[model samples]
Target: MTSSHRKGSTEGTNRVRDGGAVHVSPLELDITWGGDGRYWRIDQDRRIAELIQVCWLEVNGSVEMHHLQPNTRYKLEFKIRLKPDAFGWNDSPVYIMAMPGKGTKCIWASADLSKIRKGEQTCSIPSRLEFTTPSSSVADDKMSFGLFEIWKGRWKGGLVIEEVVISKV
Candidate 1:
């Protein structure tokens, strides 16, 4: 956790791991998935979830962001992987979005899940997502921050989400 205090941003005494304050949180047990349990599976031992296949794509999980320092530059990252037998990522890129406080931001990633190698521990290569947190304000003191998998009408699947991380950049 590197110190996230921007040069001109507000500062406070909130300790974090790594260089800045970094929070690595595993996904919750009850993750919101599309098509109920048909399209996804949870590996309780590894604490990760895999998206098998579905007509549409939508996966979401949230965590409290109160521990985030005000006015600090933070990146919300999602740890993911692509299974060897995965499909449907070559046609179009998947959309990843994060909502911090009252603001939201979106980013795009390669749809080619086949290119990613498998991880030794989990049998899937690990991928990361980094997005900035919304600037804080008095009114939006209560912020619910999380990552979501959203794509347009298409066949989307084959994504393994291990965890979500919030760290100062």
Candidate 2:
């Protein structure tokens, strides 16, 4: 795993055992107020982003389609953990949005974090947002994706983001 920052933006890449996976650290994501210490606590040493509290939630990222194996299927997931005292998730629904590449139709899927128990034990299970890549590479190289809970306008807290993984299915 390796991570770097460019112009205040974070980018990370990690190789999984399958040799076709990319692990994107939380710091690499375009998080709303991610750089602000008041709303997010970024621990460079641990390579994790912990959300202190926020009303407008948005965590976005992208990767070059070329980096992935051609004609392959993949699933995108966020590795996260909720503190025992986490709150404001009772009614709000978070959605995962993805666009395989430019000019492609965007897709959305709900990630039900509501039923997940808050604790260290449940952290091992990742919050999944499934999307398959295009069967072949397209003219546009970038595939944009994100996690959002903005519609509810609810203040949520105690969410810790480890990384987002893109792996072959």
Candidate 3:
């Protein structure tokens, strides 16, 4: 069996490794209105965040490039699930975006949560918003990423964010 250790922390961001993949708990993300009990319910025991209600949905996270293997491709994704009574996602399109650092081009990938929900027959609603990490010229650059659905002005709820997983591709 293999075990991993906490690499260290920067501004409350603690990087943990599972093999070469980094698992970022929901508590590490910068979720809008996350501190409000009315909007979000954080379960520390489960290490997940559940959305009660929100008009603007913006969940963002970042990691230093040095934490990942250099010159290698990777996929960043959010491991999430939608409650059965989930609302406000039919027309609103959520996007998963990523950028290596400042002044770099941001890559976007449309996340179809509804499609995933419809296709699954089981009670499990686990889904992912995945994006390919853009290569950076500087090895020490910080990579910023997020799942956004703020443009439509829709009120959404029933989102359960498990964590952000970044793994080599």
Candidate 4:
């Protein structure tokens, strides 16, 4: 008999293998910053890179969607935390984009970044993109998703991104 680990395997997907999902690190993503690149800094702590000093207050990243299992459900989870000095995320919602099959879907998520108590406690924010793979095939075969909302011309800063996870549901 085949081992359980070998059953129900995601053979054709790059995001999964041996019943395990792929976790994308934030540092690996394409993060846009202000002119001097000084607007953002990759803070290394215990080998963990936290995208901090994000004055741009934005995250634009993409991955190949065609590698997902067709007709299956998945969740695009963004793992992030707010620093003590974080600002400008209160009145607006973070935006995400994805293409499960044939069409593109946009999602908006909100969090209380201002209320996070520094030193006393740490808060984690999860921005999820829940979608179902299309039997017809994913359009463009690529998915672009991130955190950013245009409210004004001013710049905002101080959020930490741990990683981005693509999990089967």
Best prediction by TM-score: 2
lDDT of 3 by residue, 77-146 (tens): 7777777888888887788887756666787877666765732133322334334444555766777888
The TM-score obtained by model 1 is 0.62
> In candidate 3, which residue ranges exceed 4 Å CA deviation?
1-13, 118-140
lDDT of 3 at 163: 78
- Whole-model lDDT values for every prediction: 0.51, 0.74, 0.71, 0.54
State, as a TM-score between 0 and 1, how close model 2 is to the true structure: 0.84
Across 103-166, the per-residue lDDT of candidate 1 in tens digits comes to 4544433334445564523322223444555555555343344433345456666677766566
- Candidate 4 lands at a TM-score of 0.67
RMSD of each: 10.0, 4.5, 7.6, 10.4
| Residue 90 in candidate 4, Cα distance off native in Å | 2.5
Alpha carbon deviation, residue 123, candidate 2 (Å): 4.2
lDDT: the better of candidates 2 and 3:
2
Could you estimate the TM-score for every candidate?
0.62, 0.84, 0.79, 0.67
What is candidate 3's TM-score against the reference? Answer: 0.79
Give the candidates in order of TM-score, highest first: 2, 3, 4, 1
Off by over 4 Å in 2: 1-17, 122-128, 138-140
Candidate 4 per-residue lDDT, tens place, 31-134, comes to 55522235556543431234334434556555566556677777777666666666666555556555553365665455545555543243345445677766
Query: Where does candidate 3 clash, by residue pair?
Result: none
